[model samples]
Target: MSAAPPTVFGIARLGKRTKDLTKRLQPGDIAIIDHEDIDRVAAEALIERHPAAVLNVSASTSGRYPNAGPRILVDAGILLVDGLGDEVFEGVRDGQTLEVAGGEVLLEGDVIAHGTDQDDVTIAASLEIARAGLSEQLELFAENTMEYMLRERDLLLDGIGAPEVRTVLDGRPALIVVRGYHYKEDLATLRPFLRENRPIIIGVDGGADAVLEAGFRPDMIIGDMDSVSDRALRSGAELVVHAYRDGRAPGAERLEELGLGDEVVLFPASGTSEDIAMLLADEKGASVIVAVGTHGTLEEFLDKGRAGMSSTFLTRLRIGSKLVDAKGVSRLYRQRISTFQLVLLALAGFAALAVALWATPGGQALVQILGARLDALLSWFTLLFSPRATGS
Candidate 1:
């Protein structure tokens, strides 16, 4: 007898594998992407859509650095077929019903492409190999940082060429949010602070959506405008397009097409959107700047697949004592009362009330009333704690 064929599941949905592709993804659709060294953010967005399977044309974990993306996908029970090459995209049309089994992409009962199946064991091994190459990455990062420091010293030290914006930041706290790692959790944790303080909220790229989700309007939206939604553009937030230092504003075109040309402030600077946002706040004389989900640690920068966080490092140095991480704030700040505390406080209040009533002019009458209530309470307790009759 012939061996049984492998079970195939779900229809295929082909996309460029960019973070922008998350907007079009539907649940249970197999995502075909060309993303190499998929970062945590991209993986997270893809995972949220509940993709049936992921077929990557480019290397998901290229072993250049230990990216958490492939591991995250596999750990979530999502089937990952890594490095199928560009042929997979050429053969698989968008919305085509393709069967994926054992790392083989099948179209109309024929095997179209084959890839390495990414399971826990395979992903772990890849991560180990990637870790070994981190020394080289670190060296490259250090070099890049030094180069950036030399180039951006004027901007960092002197606040040269900082654009003037209508959104006033003088003597006010500014909350700069980025759609990076644990952004939602940080935002939720800082709810009380946001409500009480009402800091000028600045959203970087897709962070605009996050700000909206957190029930706060962004005072300023800053980025290349690639990942931000059209709704967010029309959100009445002051738009600042991050352009090149050479005065080329590509993101301005997006706003112009959306009929927001007149409202936008063109900020031409050579840095990441988060960096620009921080600099803008600092330059405008913000008293304090609280950052949510922005990359700070070395590992975090690497997780975003960056060679180095030159702009981020310089921005922090420029901001000095005013900069604070939302994660740190969330962890250290305690505002909410515990249930145990509430119960204990209630018991203490009842005891204090009894003592006060006994010391009053109507103490005798109050004691009599309390005595009757106590008797009733004892009777209720007796009934509650009494053994119930059970049927055999």
Candidate 2:
């Protein structure tokens, strides 16, 4: 079969699916770059692998919109066909031959029947539709751009030290810990650090739970009020509500319900839940802020459905060296079994073996009988006092 000129669609799911349409993309395989936002990392990976002409179904063709994927592709010299929407997918499904001239969809049919309504549709037309539906998406992109701008201004904070590690006497560094999906795992690992009071802890909404679970209370909680629990809200942690671009705080309503309006600080930013938390920590002069289970890569940022990690990316730049990603910290602090525990277990095993050997056949029989009696006795004691047994 002859290779079809690859068309990049803006939707990720479709882009991934297009691989099945062609055997092995030699030169003519059209790259359908799907995704409302082009995934820079995915695009780079795809570009490296296929080297095919790209049909960008994404929202942005110009890098001005902060869609890094498109910008990267354009820079990489990949032939990009912009603004072909669901029709592009239909084209492929029906085995249509697509033609692109100067990043414009010139002709979009071969085997597939082209509809009249779609006939006059230019790249601009598709972009207009995307703009209307994805106005929010563009804003998200813009917010990310602003966030990166903010972080760029504060690049000194990008290290692995507590905020007050050196300057203040008896001053512990400030820590911004995350408690998203990996709260338990992050807490389990961060427990010892909390115990040492290394930094002031700030939790990103649910991260407060992580702090408490790590046996510490968060000095601050940041995010829109949705995911935080009642127990977490009433846990006496200071609250910071992340608001939208208009400064209208969605979290403020929940705070009022909990009578915590006064306690709540409104932070209007266009970043993720985790981004606001770091910003709060930085604004408050936190010496060090550590993030856990926070979105770090392109996929993670996209998985959160955020068009850009603009705020997070910016916040990291703002607190550059001081903002330590928790993944890195976990890798640095991953636990190994202690030698003492190993030694103790070894001794216990030897003692158990010694006792087992000492009992001869008749003695072993007697020992077994005694052990059974002891087990029954223990069970009786457990039944009397155990919470489950006592129904208490």
Candidate No. with top lDDT: 1
For this target, which candidate reaches the highest TM-score against the unseen true structure?
Answer: 1
lDDT of 2 by residue, 266-294 (tens): 66655576766665566556667767777
Cα deviation of 30 in candidate 1 (Å)? Answer: 1.1
**lDDT score for candidate 2 against the true structure:** 0.59
User: What Cα-based lDDT does every candidate model obtain?
Assistant: 0.86, 0.59
Query: What is the lDDT for 222 in model 1?
Result: 96
Q: Which digits, one per residue and each the tens of the lDDT, describe model 1 over residues 191-248?
A: 8888999999999999999999888889999999988889888999999999898889
Cα displacement (angstroms), candidate 2, residue 243, comes to 1.5
**Per-residue error (Å), model 1, residue 366:** 3.5
Worst 10 residues of 1 by lDDT: 2-11
